[model samples]
Target chain A: MPKVTFPRMGESYRAFRMLMNDLGNEVIIPPRPNKKTLDFGVRYSPEFACLPLKILTGTYVETCMSGAELIITSGGSGPCRAGLYGQLHKKILNSIGFPVDIIVFEAPKSHPIDFLRKVKRVNSSRLSYLAIWECVKRGWEKLKYLDDLEKTTHALRPRELKKGSTTKVYREVLEWIDGAYAMKEIHEAGKEALNTLKLVPHDTRRAVLRVGIVGEIYVLLEPASNLEIEETLGNLGVEVHRSMFLTGWTRDNTVKETSGILSVKEAAMPYIPLCIGGHGRESVGHTILYARDGFDGVIQMAPFTCIPEIVARTILTRVSREHNIPVLTFFLDEQTGKAGMSTRLEAFVDLIRRKKNAPVSDNRIIVG
Target chain B: MKAYMGIDVGSVSTNIAVLSHAGEILADLYIRTRGRPLEAILAGLTEIAGLLPAEVEICGCGSTGSGRYLAGVMIGADVIKNEITAHAVAASIYVPDVQTVLEIGGQDSKIIIMRNGIVTDFAMNTVCAAGTGSFLDQQASRLNIPIADFGELALSSSAPVRIAGRCTVFAESDMIHKQQMGHKLTDIINGLCEALVRNYLNNVGKGKEILSPVVFQGGVAANAGIKAAFERALGLPIIIPRHFGVMGAIGAAQLAREEVEKTGQTLFKGFKIAGLPYRTGSFECGGCPNNCEIAEIYEEDRVIGRWGARCQRWDVL
Candidate 1:
């Protein structure tokens, strides 16, 4: 079987590795990105490309070094620049002497034969239809479990009795989910993960500030790209509710959108009315939804120069005004240092906390 | 008399303010940081201590500005807050119904919108220092005029010329071209002020509602020309607080008072720390591939606090 690799996007890569391994390919899981990866990415990629593309470029570079023969990444067809990143990455890699084939899983409806051929290349062992179905089902189930654990972790982080205990359990659960191979093992791991989370000592009566995170999917998922914003907020005693999860994203694009169930596009129609691509419409829609849900504040994070999010960010100011909720936008790039980001976040949390407590007609002085 | 102390360690200046329980500014001192925050903070503290009445006691202390963490750790701050919150607090407290706050400091500028004494929204300059006080300071020195005189000189302009206010690089070049074209010094100075106001409104103040009762407070609020330009641009009177330059410090003092009163105790290390030996240094931890640079604060050879690590391995507070 040929060695295949894909860029890391948070914990979703483990499920992707499982899928590729089940399809009979030697899936080389790329290392979790760090400063070195970002440095390599910034050095090789074009200066103006958004952060995700640069990170992915760095991922591909490290993946090639790990003896991966081919790269597989999802492709987009929209106004967002991500659609063209696969081709750009390929050319850049080829020029840098890593002559590897890149297979992009574009919308299957657009080019069914091309998609099938690319799939066959990875499924070199000629897995039967039943086997492929089973492999896909297992991958899907694992992704769902991972997303559920993450959602629970977000809710639990603010209320945990011991600081960082919930995160420790969450990390252990992630490893358990990653280690599980068979369907039965996966089921057992998921149940055990939930039970383990339940065991985390938490205060149900403690009032915590709630913040919703909405923006581009890549930055939202990849902690390395976003400076671990969710963790930072959670540690600051905030209940973070993010708009996108992998399973929800998968369902939205594949099944939900077509079936007219849970459509962010429709929710966004009153504001944006059209898909500007790269989760921008979803960002606006999610901000409105979060506002309607009475979240104290909404944070929109995007890589610098991401056209779609920029559009969403501009419109979000109006959404913030009308919804009477504070919105803070962060344009992430290589130069975005941790100290500065934390300062802004701390101030934002302070703002929302004060706003929430503003109804008290006296002794208006409040600080934490 | 009991007082709360606040120290704002900014990029350019270290401001120390002592406020009474009633929020009246009792004593304040502003010292140039000159790239050394620790010495500046210590000097400011000593000077502020001397300026206050000998009987006045420091009941609480807070720190703000870019170097807030360093200041907070050193002084044992009761409340360490960001510049945005500090400024908004000071503005709302001083003006009572301040709907907007325009604060331009050494390296950054921020626009804060408030409603009913609560900060509704705020924005700081993102990755740009073009329209801030430092640029104006640089241009003033380059023009052979003291920064203190730049504003008055601008106010004397009769026929102010127009300059592009998009980027600092372009603005500097445009200013030179205007100077070489034999434009009057005051005209060019006023023009520069207008350009900076335009750039600030476009960039940092973008998409923000600049309602009335705007309070302009920061180091740059000392500039009459910028104030005039802002008044022209927004068509509203800009209120510069009596302690405009040290409003961040004042806000910090207010926050400290609030926190100290609620908790019934202060974390202040006391005014005696001004004479103590303090040192700060950073080292790259090679524990992981990230190689995070860990910053350490030391008092007489013992590490008091450590931070900046992605992992909390060295985060001993």
Candidate 2:
């Protein structure tokens, strides 16, 4: 019966909460997304008007309506919109009459001390350590399952018979994982899902190029934000491997603490670290990761006014050429045209597949 | 007779310059980045290649700007530095005591605060276009003022009006409102300059110390209107160096000279850099549990650079 709220992604939190929580305090569901939520968002938000914000604004309202005194949240920074989301949420919630205490779980601004402060907020009375430990274990397990499943989906994307069938199967399996009772059950279920989907009988000899989509999680995740670049690429017979995962999301903290210059995650390296600064640094790091992971190409996805990604995109092209990986960028705004986007994706994939012998990045565009 | 080349690849423009030991521009080319810095850099280098001596004295190359790291590897730059350091080096040679440097480029803006000719603090608005040249370009187009006339018109404004300044949306809306209020077009346009400068001071230039002998460079410094607006905001005259937009390229060339004189050996691969066939790839290191993703850049088949490796460990290989 735990009341939990998270920023909306694909579907209603009401249907998803049964998957997010196990049994606990009563769940306080947020109202469905509407103009009222958008209004609250703009009124309270810092005029950026990104959609994930509307969901966040509503989450707070519903949490207050349900009278939840405690809230759980995390912090992020970016070469994308999510970097300042935590600060925006705090400000918006404060303005719209929701004064519920919010615990930002991911501020490692001071390393372990920040985390320790947040842990104290998770009901530090009796079962504190146990509760925190359990939460970490579960979250880690969830991320591993998610990354592994998604990675498997990426590998088998070229072989899936139906449109987004790998995604569809992965989604079903993930929903099952949320309710899964045991680790063995999760393992078996993952294997079963993979086995069932790999049997879709796709032609393995088509040789579709692999495209790595990297950028703000929202632009990369939401089809509309990215102008359906993934779908466009998939339709073009190019397999899309999205680089941002919950694992990368979690790993970004180490990048953030080092402020993008130092790889805090790696202690023994002797290279002169280039901190792109902020979450944009993570974008460069991840894009390069995609190149190294055998993607024939990379796409630096972003919105109209994003700062960090702009900085990161410059570096990504060099990385692509240096690595012989082709990169195409898709920057979206309200004016972004689907036809234009599809044309670009189709042409880019064709270029990569056709001219694997040519050179890295013979094409580039800036959506002004 | 040692010569060095430098490239400044930005999202908006690609600048290339080759300098002699005596600090003369032997060959320089400026090309609109047109959103493709790589293409621009390559094209510019190709144009300059025919202009240089076939067997020029060897020297190092350096690159710095928004596209520095990429330009570095592409051109085989011997040194790569941030715009603040590179710009400061070039500006210090020109102004010697530029305490403050305000640079407005196509998509990014930076404020470099220096003390005694050394950079102390710097802030940049790479995200906000309201304080950059793009803002001026949009305002110019929306107001129907030829971008070339935008500066002169601002100079004639009887009373500069108020613009929202915080965001381009509000600023555009405010401009429309001012237009409807019977304000002269020049006044409204001049007001935009004020609004942009005001917003820059309040946002990117906030809380940092601003000293005199200030120099403004970058692509936007060519606009006399912006220069005037900055002087009005600071109540002090500012200096615009002779070569403004390509200061980054100039800085790179200057840095290459300094490095070559210091190390007495240059890493510049040569003019054939443009013709070299390069290759690169990415991989995940299972060396440890981190499973760090790594990217390696190669020339032909030899590794030239490694990035995205969380630990420099892979780079050591």
Candidate 3:
């Protein structure tokens, strides 16, 4: 069996590992991205590449160095620079003497046979197409479970009586979910995780800031990419409402658009009116939805020089104004300073809190 | 006799202000940090402590600015806040209906938009300090003119020349080009001020609704040229508060007073903290590949607090 590795993106690595293992390929998990990984990426990759690409490049390098024979990463066709990242990573890795075989997973909609063939390359067990589909379905189920766990954690974090307790439970639940292979075991683990989370001694009466996070998917999901923004906000007593999740993204891209749910296109039609690639349209649409839902504030985070998000950033100004909501945009890159980020977040929280507590014309408090 | 103390330890300056229980500024000291925050803070504390009457007692203490955490730990602050909120609070206190706050500090600049005395939106310079005080300081020295006189020279200008304000390097070259083209010194200086104000408005002030009753407060608010430029650009009279330079410190003190009153006690360690021999040391933590530089504060060789680690492993306090 060929040794294969995939770049880590939040909890998606777990699902990818499961899929690879079931396909009978030896799976090598890349190190969780850290300062050294970022340093490697920044040193080797082009300075202008988006942060996710650079971080992925660093992950691939480290994985290859650790004796992995094959690297797998997602591919896309869009105006967003993300489409070219896989190729860029491959070139950058090969030039740096890694020379590992790279497989890019494109959307089945665009290249069904190519995608299946690429998947078959790592299907060392020579599993039938039906068996491979089953493995993918299980992986998708794991992603759904992970996202559910994350959402519950985000909501409970602000109201927990004991500080850092929610995070502790979240980590323990994540470990159990990762270790479970049987669908029944995974389902039980998820149910137990929710029950445990519900028992985490929370004060429902506590007045917490409800902030919506909208941005490119990679930066929004990856803690290292966004500098642990969700945790930082939660620790500051704000309930984070993320507008993007991996499972939702996979569903939107791969299957029929679910009706009745707030469609990104329709919600964004008023402001953007077009898909500009990446999550740019979604970012705008979500900000509007969050504003209409009376969120205290919205934070738009994206990699530096990301064209799609740059468009979204501009449109967000109007969304913020028309909706009377405050929006803070962060362009994350290697040069981003930690202290600066914290300061901005603290100030943003104070801004929304004051707005929430301020008396309106009727002398009623606006608690959002 | 009861007072609150606020300390703002910034990259360029360390400001200490003492406010009586009634929010009256009793004593304020502004000292250049000069790349040594602790020393500057201690020096400011010593000066302010001496300036206050012997009967006065610090009932609460707060810290704000980039070095706020360090200052807060050192002073046993009841409240620690970011500079944006501190500046907004101070501006609202001075002008109850303040709608906008333009703060240009040493290394950064901020534009805060307020509605009904509450901060609605705010932005700071992102990854660039192009039109901030530091750039002005460098330009002043390059022109062989003292920083204090740079504003006056701008005020005396008859015809302001146009200069690019996109980046510091480009701005400097543009100034030199106009200077070599025989533009008067005052004209170039005024032009530079206008350029910086334009840059600030287009960058940090981007998309912000800058309304009337706008207040400009920060270390750079001392410059009349920038104020005049802001007034000209926005077509609204800019109000420079009496304690504009120490507004952040004043706000911190005000917050401290509120916190102490709510908690019914103060965490202030007293003015004697200035005399304490505190030592600071930092080391790269080997626990992870992040190699976060863990900063530790010591009192008489005993570690009092540790910070700067990304993870909780080295976060003992």
Candidate 4:
């Protein structure tokens, strides 16, 4: 059987690895993206390509270098550069002498049968339909558990009495979830993790700033690429609510079809009448939703030269003006300095706090 | 008799300002950093200390600008703020109804949009150096004219030529071409100012609503030529505050006062700190593959501060 490898995105790799493993294919999960990973990608990638593309290419190269013969990655069917990443990666890898079979899953919207066929290829065991269904069900359970642990950590980080306690508990819980072999064990470990998080002392009285983070999925999910923005925000006493999750994105793009995706498109209609590809529409839609839901501020993070997010950003300025909600955008690249980013974040937080605490008659609408 | 002190240690300059309880500037000094922020800060502090009366007490101190953390640690600042917040706060105090603040310092420029005395939107020009003060200074010297005289000369021009100001290199070559084309020196200078103003408005002020009561300040505010160009570009009267050059320091001082008022205590290290020996060094951490170069600040061989590691391994100590 061919050894199949997939790039890491948050905790989605856990479910992907399990599903691939259960299907009797030898699975090799590339190491978590770190500085070395980013450096490799940066060295091989076009200078102006978005950070995610470079990182993904780097992961493929690393996995291929480690003797993996087959690479599985997603494909997009939109105007965004992401749709072409798979083709570009294959070309770049082959030119670099790393010959490997590449499987680019077709977008379910255009080629549902092809997507199903590609998925079934991972099931080399040729198990009974019931067995395959059971394997998928177990994989999903673990994915949901991981997502829940992250959500709890996000909520508790800003409120924890002890600085860094939430992160400590979050790391331990992730370990527990990753180590669990059975569905029952995963649920038990998740419950124990939630209980452990709850035990951390917290201050409920402090008026914490609530911020909505909307942006490109890779930059949003990958902590190393974004310089740990969530952790930085949490430490600065701001509670962050991210608009994207791995399972949520997967469901919206595949199983649910247009149901969950339509609401966001509808919300973004007044601002962006057309989908500009990638997560551009979703970024605008989520910001408007967050503003209407009374978030203190919205922050949009995207890689430099990211066309889709740039289009969304220009529209967001108008959204911010019309709705009276503050919006800050950060364009991340390889040369982005941590200190500069931190300074901007600090200034933004201070601005939000001052606006929130100001007297009501100041002619500024209190959004949160 | 008590005063709050604010220090702004920037890459190009170090500024210190002392404010009375009524938020009045008592003493302020602006000194070139000359690649030595520590020495510049010490010299600034020593100068201010010598100018103040014996009865005046230094109650609180704050730090801001790029070197804020280092200066804050060295001065024992009660409050440490980023340049944006410090600049916004200071601009607000100078013009209570300020809606827009255009700050062009030595190496960086920023546009801060305000609504109801609160900063609503802001953009900084860290990536581009064309629209900043240093570029203007460079042009002034290349023209064989003092930077102080360049602005006044520009104001005297009857017809200002157009110079491409998208980037420093292009603008410099364009200026040379115009000079060879036999344009009047004053016309060329005025055109340079207009080019910088155009670049700033397009880059830093892009997609931002510039509302008046617009207050323009920073080291670059001294240029009457740029001020006139801004007024023409925005079609509004640009107000330069009384203490334009030291606004960041002033804002830092104001923030220090606010912090001290709330806590009724200050962590000021006193003027004697100027005499202490401080040194900074860096070493690459090998704990992980990141290999972050951790910087450490030493006072008489005792490490006072350490930073630059991405992970918490070197941070917690």
User: Judged by DockQ, which candidate is best?
Assistant: 3
**Candidate 1 C-alpha lDDT tens digits along B213-250:** 99998999999999999999999999999999999999
Please give the CA lDDT of all the candidate structures: 0.88, 0.66, 0.87, 0.87
Highest lDDT scorer:
1
> Quick one: best TM-score, which candidate?
3
TM-score of 2: 0.50
- Off-target runs (Cα >4 Å) in candidate 1 are A255-262, A360-368
- Descending-lDDT candidate ranking: 1, 3, 4, 2
- Which residue pairs in model 4 clash with each other? none
Lowest-sum lDDT 10-residue window in model 1 chain A: A253-262
Q: Per-residue lDDT for B1-317 in model 3, tens only?
A: 99998999999999988999787899998899999887888788889889999999889999999989888888889999999989988898889999999999999899998878778889999867887999999998888898998888899999869999999989999999999999999999999999999999988998888999999999899999999999999999999999998999999999999899899999988888889898899988888665777888886677767877765676554
Better of 2 and 3 by DockQ: 3
TM-scores for all predictions:
0.95, 0.50, 0.96, 0.93
lDDT of 4 at B27: 90
The clash tally of candidate 3 reads 0
Winner by DockQ between candidate 4 and candidate 3: 3
How is the predicted docking of candidate 1 categorized under the CAPRI scheme?
A: medium
